[model samples]
Target: MIELRGVHKAFGANQVLRGVDLVVPRGESMVVIGGSGTGKSVALKCILGLVHPDAGTILVDGQDVTGTDRESFLARFGMLFQGGALFDSLSVWQNVAFRLQRGAQRRSPVQAREIAVEKLRRVGLKPEVADLYPAELSGGMQKRVGLARAIADDPEIIFFDEPTTGLDPIMAGVINELIREIVVEMGATAMTITHDMTSVRAIADNVAMLHDGVIKWTGPVARMDASGDPYLDQFIHGRAEGPIEAVR
Candidate 1:
């Protein structure tokens, strides 16, 4: 239920997003894949209104994102940051219930904790773990905690920024599975920015390859391998020689 039409953004002389066009259908997972500095994150930030585009439009369910009531508009979305991004001083439950304890979704402390425990359970964390701090958890556990926080408010849309970063292959696999399951379970519209092909394969219903600040290809995940686009092919194969120039 999100669409970007000819979106363009640039910082001084450095053009980050150049006429990006993308669409994310409701209740489906859309993964945007690209190498570093290809504007994947900039596109996301534009959609979220964190960065205003210099040209074109971003619409969510048909309304331009720039005109919405900031708080209410943002309440409809949840985010799982690239890093775990947990507060060192906060307990696990507190972190999970962060959104629930403030703004429009405010809940009583007890109610928030109850929901936090339930969300933690969904992410495979025990209630006892809620009393512990982020430093006490493994990277995998920390990511799970971030996932729990993302869904704690039962948002209609979720944004995952490099969901499988900084984890081992096995841990990354677990996180990917969790992301897929959670999106399906919540029926939430998901847009994820990640270069991780494993994450793309596991979590995407559709894939969009961002290269040179634009979408090089967009199609169903099933059609990705056969899409025959040089940019996407190079990215998915991690090829050193292709249209995408690898830095020396």
Candidate 2:
């Protein structure tokens, strides 16, 4: 569903992505794993058009997204940001229904709220919690709300950035399971970038290891352990010694 070829992006003297080539098949969960400053997030932003590539091409469903209509292009996507990124002024239901209440696909407030509440339930949040503000909830609850919002419009593609960050192991596991279940139920194409091995194991059908602004490895999750790539080994095992530089 998504493909990138020779994608390059640089910021001043720092070159983040030298030549990133990746493909996420339709209805599959592909998780990009890499160490910090390895351009995982930059790669994602490039596809989302938040960061323009200096060269190369990005195609969604075999069509170039470069000059596509922004509104229509974005309507097919849903994203869960690294942090909850909820609007402080909005209640939980309002935040989840944010997309439904605006733009070309706008819906009535009642309809939006009902959809929001249903999504919240899908992510394991009670309907009453939708009336509460973000600040009133715990970190895990906020993440669930974010998940609810991402799926609110039933997007065809979903991007999850650091889905398991800032949560206890148990909560992280819960969130990971929820992500996997939702993706399967919705049959949406998913691309996730995370350093969390547990999250990758839980949510990915395929894994791609990004290092030095390029994909060092890409394969099914089942074959990851036997892939025999030093970079992939170093990452999945959290080793200090390997081909990857630890200081970076």
Candidate 3:
């Protein structure tokens, strides 16, 4: 459903993306794995148009993303940022329904709240948590709220950035399972960037490992173990020594 070809980006003296080419098929979950400075997030930003690419093309369902209508194009996507990024002042339900309460896809206040509640429930949150603010919730609850918000619009495509970054292992596992379930149930095309192997195993139908600003390896998740790419082996095994320099 999504494709990037010869994508490149640079910042002043820092060349981030050399050339990134990737494809995420419709209704499948594709997880990207990489080291800290491999430009994984930059690749995502390029696809989202938050950071313009210096060259190459990005297509969503065969339509060039650059030529698409901004509002309508964005309405089809949902994002779960690494930090949850919930508004501090809004109640949980309001945060979840924020997209639905404004712009072209706006809904009635009552309808928005009802949809929010249902999404929260889908993410394993309770109705009682709706009125609470971000400050009132635990990290896990906050992540669930973020997940609830991402799926609130029932978007056809969802992007997850470091989804298990801050939570404890058990909670991270829960989030992983929730992500897997949501993607399958919603039939959404998912692209996730995470270093967590467990999350990759749980949420990905396919995996791509980014190294030196480009895809070093990509295949069905089940084939990862025998891919024979040194970089992929180093990353998946968390090896201290390999083709990838650990000093960086």
Model 1 over residues 30-61: C-alpha lDDT tens digits? 99999988888889989888899999999999
Clash list (residue pairs), candidate 3: none
**What TM value does model 3 have?**
0.98
User: What would the per-residue lDDT of candidate 3 be over residues 127-193, giving only the tens digit for each residue?
Assistant: 9999999999999999999999999999999999999998999999999999999999999999999
Tens digits of per-residue lDDT, candidate 2, 1-248, equal 99999999999999999999999999999999999888999999999999999999999999999979988999999999888899999999999999999998899999999999999999999999999999999999999999999999999999999999999999999999999999999999999999999999999999999999899999999999999999999999999998988897
Go through the candidates in order and give each one's C-alpha lDDT: 0.93, 0.95, 0.95
Better candidate by TM-score, 1 or 3? 3
How many residue pairs clash in each candidate at the backbone level? Answer: 0, 0, 0
Q: TM-score for all predictions?
A: 0.97, 0.99, 0.98
Off by over 4 Å in 2: none
Candidate 2 has what TM-score?
Answer: 0.99
Better of 2 and 3 by lDDT: 2
What value does the lDDT take at residue 80 in candidate 3? 94
